[model samples]
Every structure is written in C-alpha cells, then in structure tokens.
Target: MQKKLLFLCLFLFVEVITAQQDILSEQAEISVLTIGPGALLNDSFGHNAFRVKDPVKGIDLAFNYGVYDFETPNFYLKFAQGKLNYLIGLNYYEDFFEAYISQNRSIKEQVLNLSQIEKQKLFDYLLNNIKPENRRYLYDFFYDNCATKIKDVTNIALNNSIQFNDPRDFKPQTFRELIHSNLNRNSWGCFGIDLALGSVIDKKATPEEHMFLPKYIYRFFEVATIKNSNKPLIKKSNVLYEKIDAPVPSQFLTSPLFIFGILGGFILFITYTDFKKQKQSVWLDITLFSLTGIIGILILLLWFATDHKGTHQNYNLLWACALNILVIGQLLKQKTSTWFIKYLKFLVILLCLLTLHWIIGVQVFAIGLIPFLIALFIRYLFLIKYYSNRH
Candidate 1:
C-alpha cells in the first residue's frame, strides 16, 4: 500500500511540473504572417497564419487555417456543396516560409504588441485549437476563411479588446470588386465568379468584413488599436521575403474576350443571313434556345440547390430565360403559336431590363459577356420580326 501511494504521488508531481513547463516564456513572440498571392486560383487571395516562436523553449510553429483534406470523402461534391471541412494545420515556421519562398510569393510578418500574458494566452489558444477534435471547421469564403480566422482568433486572445481603425488609404468597395482587384478582369476566373455569384455581393463591404482578404488583414492590423488603453496593436513589421518579378506569357486566341467575340460575330452573321433570306434557320434557333435554357437551369440550381451563399439572388436569369426551353417546339412547327412572337418580344424586353440592372448597379456582369448579350438581343429582334411577318 505504501509503495503504491508513493508512486501515485510521484506521478501527480510529474504531471504538475509538466503542465507548468508548457507555459510560454516571457521571451516568446507571436506574429501574424501574411503570404502574398500565388498564380493558382486557390492561392489568388493569399493566406494568413499565426507564427509562435520561442527560442528559449526551442519552439517554432505556424498555425494555418487554410488547409483542406482532399482525401476526405466526396471532396469535389462537398466543395461544390460548400460543406467541405477546412482544418487547422501546424507546421514548422521554417518549412512554412520555405514553401512560400519556393512559389515566389512574398511573406510579411507583424509582431503584435500584446502583453506577455496575452501572448501566452494566444499561444495556448492556438495550441488548443490545433487538437484533433477542434481543428476542423466549416469553411466560408467571405466570413470564416484563413484571414478571418486569424482576425477572429486574435480578437479572442485579446478578449475582444482590439479596435480596428480604418487605414487612411482605405476605400470602401463591394465584395465582388474586392475579389476583382486580385484577378484579371478578362480572365476565365473573373468570368466564372461573375456568373456564379449573385447580386448580394454588390453591396459595399464593411471595414471589418474587408479582413476576409489577407492583404486587408495586414493593412487593418497596421492601424488597429487596443480598445481599453488606445495603444497600437502592432509593435513592429518586417518584410520576410519579396517576390521576384516573372511575367506570365499571354495568349490572346485562348482568352475569353477573343472567344466570345468570335461567337458573337457568328451570331450576328447568322441573324443577317436570316434577315436577307426572309427565312429562319431551325438549327440555329434550336441551338440558341437550348443553350440558354441549359444555362438558366444551371443558374437556378446553383442558386437554390447549392449551399453557396453568394450564388443566391442572381439576376442573370433575365437573359438566360428558362421559358426559352418550353417554346423550343414552336421553332420546329411550320407555323408557330400566336403567343410565341410575344414570348420573343418579352425576351427583348428582359434584355433591356438586364441593361437597366447593369446601369443602376443592381449587379455587375462579366465584361466578356458584353458581346454575347448584344448578339442575343439582335437575335431576339430578328425572331420577333420573322414571326410577325409570318403571322
């Protein structure tokens, strides 16, 4: 009995000592590392992570919230459904920097002006978050992404005492515009975003909401203050690495603008031929209606069925009308229904409304779509005239 009690006491003493030793030392430092954007779509918006370095404790680790486990079941489906889980990843600080460096991306670090106790608290919180059960979180592009995670965790560590002052050069912009700043306006990525996302992103984003992007996090942190004491939040800043310039070769033939321009030219040519011949092309009408209808169906599905918040309330439906599908049978008939002409007229009116929406800032559309919209308008006009002449 005495031997067992002695062993238990020793075990308890060792556990207490180990627990106490886990605390961060006064010399430890915590920083926010902002990685510049890479060439890939996934890395275009850049990334943010926490760096905890303690030379005395021989500890140097980076806590990143942007990692996704592609090996997860139904990865692509889950990503499309917005149900993919992003997990907190821990890596050695040197390894993390090296990876970014190899990609030719810049790295910037900001040492936060937190009290020693606050620093230790922040370190402890990050360590706790990296635990197996606590690591995974439902990823949200606008709200709970890597940059927002860093902002949120810092706020938590400071007990919500951080006051983010807007930087002097700050300009309020819509979420879509903010995203566009990082992407080439003529690129396929920009076109896809304008197509998939809806009008909800047209509203101006709040200053705090701007932290969703990593660069904004760095900018806001540079001017942020402690709420209680009104002290600056960042003590020092350093540029760890600067990206070297390497220009990407451009290919105009494969670009969206060029391809869409060709498509629009063909549409105009077909419409002109139909006008001169005083006859409609059955195949052309079928192709146009079918393609637009399919696109409309896809838009509707993305808006209603998908978990993507930005896809809701889309107004692109005005041009890609789903009603086009129902009237496809009329094109095959020798003489169409009386209401079919009116339907074509209605489509023309809807196109006008789409222009109105664009002008009034109801939604911003892809610039590459301009030629397509013009061609579609002219095609509808031709159809209206053809039906009227036959009637």
Candidate 2:
C-alpha cells in the first residue's frame, strides 16, 4: 500500500510539472534589460538580461548568461587558461533591477513583440536551461558572451525569424576599437588589455558580431523586426533608471601613460649619464634585461600555453626578448664577448621590425607604451655603443 502511494505521488508530481509547462497566459510579457556601465573594469562594458513576466502565473524573473561560481574547482586557473565555464543565472526581476540600480547604473527595458507562442517558447527554454546540467556554457569573449547570448537565445527560440536592422548611425569597427569605445584609452585597464591581448582583436567585427556588446544589443534590438512580416521586434522601450551625471574622475596621475612616461624619462636620464661617463651601468643593464626577459616569457606563455585566442600574434615580443635573460651572464662580465655587441644590434633590429609592424597596421600596440618604447630604443643604442667600445 505504501509503495503504491509513493508511486501515485510521483505520478502526480510529474503531471503538475507537465501542466505548468504551458501555463503562461495571453497577458505574458517578455523584455530585454540593458544595464549601463559601472565605474569598475568588470562592469565597464555593461550587462544584459531577459525579463519574463506572467501576471496570471505570478511569474516574474530575470534570466542572464553571465554568472560563474567563484567556488568552482580550479576556478582561477581555468579562468586564466580561458577554460572556465560561465553559467546562466535565474533571479527575481525585482531583485535584478534593484541590484543594478543600487550601483547607480542606468537600466533600460525593451518589451519584445514576440507572439504568445514565441514568448512561451522562450520562457520555457529559460526554465529548462536553468537546470544544473544545462546551465553552464563555454564563454568566449567575442563570439559567445552575455550580450551575444541574448541574440543567440532569442533567435533559437524564434527559429531565426528576426531581422536586425542597423542603427541610424551605425559604423564598422574592429573588436579592439569596439572595446576601446567603452574604456578610457589611457586607463591602466586599457594598458593591461593592450599588453596581454594581441593583434587578432584588431580585425573588423561584422554587424551582427557588434551585438557582442550590451549597448549594441540594445541598439540592434531597437531596430529589429519579424522576418515573415515586417512587424517591429520591440513593442515598447523605456528607461527604468537613469544615472545622474557626475564629474569624471581625473586618472592622469594613476594612468598608464603618466606612470610609464615618468619611468621612461628616468631610463633616458640614466642612459645619458652612462654615455657621458663613457662607462656602462652594469646593474641597470641587468635589471632591464631581467624585466624584459620575464615579460617576453609571459607573453609567449599567454600565446602558446593558454586557450585565449586574443593573446596570439603578439608583436610585443620584438621588444621584450626572452633571450635577454640568457645573456645576463654576459652583461655581468667586465670584458664580454664580441657576439654580445652583435646581439645588442639584433635587439635593435627587432625593435625596427616592431616599428614596421606598427606602421603597416599589422598590430596596434598600446599607445601608452610609446614613451617607454622610445626610451628603450635610445638605451639599446647606447648599450650597443658602450659594448662596441669595450670590444
């Protein structure tokens, strides 16, 4: 009798869940939420989420594809290796809105003009996707991120029946340019990005690919339409919260350009002093070699050791040569070999090649590194001369 009762309860539970599958009433609404950028680097590109509301079913929730658990096994390691998985998150719509609003970020909502069937399909899809097994997805910065997922999932739900029209002021831009649009050019974040990421990001992104950003997601969706019929995709759009304008904080003192500029000047000053005395600063040479060698090794590791595609095709290796580390013993010698002078010349040639790469638009390096590169060039020339004289 107890076994039969347990079986009956299980059957009823399945039936209840099955019934709720199509429970969304005709009054259901689906919308996209665009949250504005925050001050932090992580939030600078903004965010996107889907808002699903069904008054009859008392279902109001936000669905986003940008979540990742910090406690995941090998989290930081996977993140650095670009092997981390990001998860789709489900939350109450009110909580989602309040969270962004509390951060003083602007929020915009676009009510989609999806058919009742399409709405239910999308809502159900989200419900199914939030399952533990289905929640995680391999996250790619350019191809498949939170913003791109919005378009991807919608098209999947609608069976690719939507057409995205270009905005009035649409313009083509490279991925790096697109990223730079959302960042301060001289900011430390930008400097680090330029240093770590390579030239692949300089390639142009397609119109659809531009939707990888949340702002572009909002822009394209605003002008999108149904394919079979030219019906608009967005029925209504409104700003839920508008951030008050505030004075931009000056970053000059803390910026990469400023810091690198000062360091570069010091290097030139030391080189000038060494040149005047007709004597080399052995300690300075050792320090510079060690720093450049370490940086070069790191770049090589980022390119070959990691799964990050953006770190490939780096030309910064021209300046930061790993061979410099192996030659530190030569620099320590009072009277070094003649080949050491030739090696210094070889380093200069690599710098010239780097310049050629830059001029030909092969790779766009960090502009903030300009002063440092110039200083490095002069120092290299001085070292070559000093070593040649000793030889």
Candidate 3:
C-alpha cells in the first residue's frame, strides 16, 4: 500500500510538472504578429507576403497571406517648378509610351523605336482582351513616356511629399523606410532617368495628356516590375479588362447594377400592386419580404466582402432580374403598406449607393457592412418569432 501510494504521488507530480512546463513554453514562444516592414509595402499596395509559421526551408511554420496584388506603382517627386510630378514607371512606362506611339505610329517609330514596338505589342494585347476601354489609361501611360525626357527625375523623401502614397496606408507608418527598402531591393536605388525629367517638364497640355504621359510611364516600370509585385492579378485583370469592351463610366456614376435594378423593380412592384384585395396572409407578406431581403442583401454583401477588384460577375444581375420578376408577379395580386413601401424605398437607395461604390473601383470589404448587419438582425428576429408562434 505504501509503495503504491508513493508511485501514484510520483506520477501525479510528474504530470503537474509536465503541464507547468508546457504552459511556460507556450507563454515564452507566443508569437505577437507585428506587421513587418516587408509586409507593410507589399500588403498596402494589395500585395500579400505573410510569413509562414512553419516554413519548410527558411524557418518554422509561417502565416501564408495569399497572392500579391499590385496595381500601377509610381514615385512622386517635386519638380524644379515646385509642381508635383509623379513618375509612373515599369508597367506604365511601356503603357504610356505605347499609347503615344499607336496614335502617331508613323512618327513614333521614327522618334522612339523601342517605345513604338512596346506600344504596338501592348495595344494589340489590350485590344484583344476583355475590356478595351478600361485599358485606355494604359494607352495614355504609353504616350506619357514617349513625351517625357529620360533624365530629369530626383527622389524626394516620402514625408515631405505625400501626394501619391496609398490612401489605404496614409495614416502613419514607416512609408519612407518601405520606399527606401523597395527602391534598393528593386535596383531603383537611384531615381530613374525619366523621374528626373518629370521634375523639370511643365508643359501646358491638358491634364489628361500631361498626367497620362508621365503618370503611367512611371507607374508601369516602378509598380509592375520593381520588387517583383503582384503580376498575376495585374495580368488577369488586364486580360479580363481587354476582353470586355465597356467605356469608363463618368465619375458621377457610383452604384453596382444589380442593386439598382432589383431595388427599382421592388419599388415598381410596391407602387403598382394592389395587396389589400388579395389579402396576402401576414405570414406571406413577411415571408416574401424576409426572403427577398435576406437573399438580396446576402448576395450583395458577399460580393462586397470577397470579390476582387476590377472584376464583376453578371450572376448578381441575373439573380436580381429573376427576383424582380417574381416579386412583380406576386405583387400584381397583393397589396403592400405605405410604411413598408417607404422602408423598401430606403433600402433601394442604400443598395444603389452600394453599387455606385462598387462601380468606382472601391473595394467592397473596405466599406463596412453595418447596413447588412442591421437588415440581417431584423430579418432573423422576425423569422424566429414567426416560427416560434407556429410551433
């Protein structure tokens, strides 16, 4: 008995020690994820380079932030004239140079041989893609380079000049550090020849021509190629845009199509349908509204939440059209209330705003889902009460 008790005590003590050791080790090794300087620049410009928690080759496991998302990158510098000049290099360099060449191919070939060839190839590639018009800026980017002198640029510290920092990360971080690091890493350690030139040239051309020529040329080279940025997204988006030939909407147009279309149909249904005569059961009224509201809002919210920038799926439109038809059909025989109508009208306006934001190249996720949250809470509350009574 004594021996057994002693062994049992020893085992319990061992277990306690093991547990304590584990707790201590865990506390000691806990990784507080500080946003690394590397991650800041990559993620800010829509690139993802998260550390692997258990990296197979370099370190232990690292967190994986999937694919880098890069758009046009530019280095903004103050010119000799004190006006801000943005050098859009890499992706925009070829882009702007090409656009000018295509317009004056005969002249450009003579004036800028390398630029003309690059532009011709780019134009051919763009015209063959999904959206010829969206990529028009690409043409302008090409033009800008052809006009820009190759040696008038100088790099200014990002602090004194904050004209073109990603608005997303404008709120205080080591932006200057990131720029320095990126420039050094990408062989852009010295300011480019064109960037130097941009600082001196203050042409009296229209904003489009002036901006386009310099902005895209600088963006193309610096943003697209330097630092080995998010080429896949750019390639995919560019390819997708090239295939579709939609003209750029005016700045005033802001909403997504499905939001407005569905809301418009809902409003018309409420306006024209006579619900009193049909005597739609309270359950039916709630059911129709709840179902439509939840589904519609979910679709929009999901699109806002996860959909990538510069891509729109027409499935949302198709769903809206179908839902509108059904709602209209149902309302033809039933009547809706004035209060209910007003609520729906308000919903429509919000939905229109949502669409507009979407059309303007704003990320949906960045826009909070407060409206959707409220709609969901109200809907689920009604559903729970209605079901509870039936049961």
Query: Model 1: residues >4 Å from true position, as ranges?
Result: 1-21
Q: 279-310 in candidate 1: lDDT tens per residue?
A: 88889889999989988888898899888899
Backbone clashes under 3 angstroms, per model: 0, 0, 66
Give me the displacement of residue 74 in model 3, in angstroms: 40
Q: Give the TM-score of candidate 3.
A: 0.21
Model 2 C-alpha lDDT per residue in residues 258-282, reported as the tens digit of each score = 8889989999999999989998888
lDDT of candidate 1 at residue 220, scale 0 to 100: 99
- Please identify model 3 stretches exceeding 4 Å from their true place: 1-218, 222-369
Instruction: Tell me which residue pairs clash in candidate 1.
Output: none
What's every prediction's RMSD, in angstroms? 6.6, 5.3, 24.6
lDDT score for candidate 1 against the true structure: 0.89
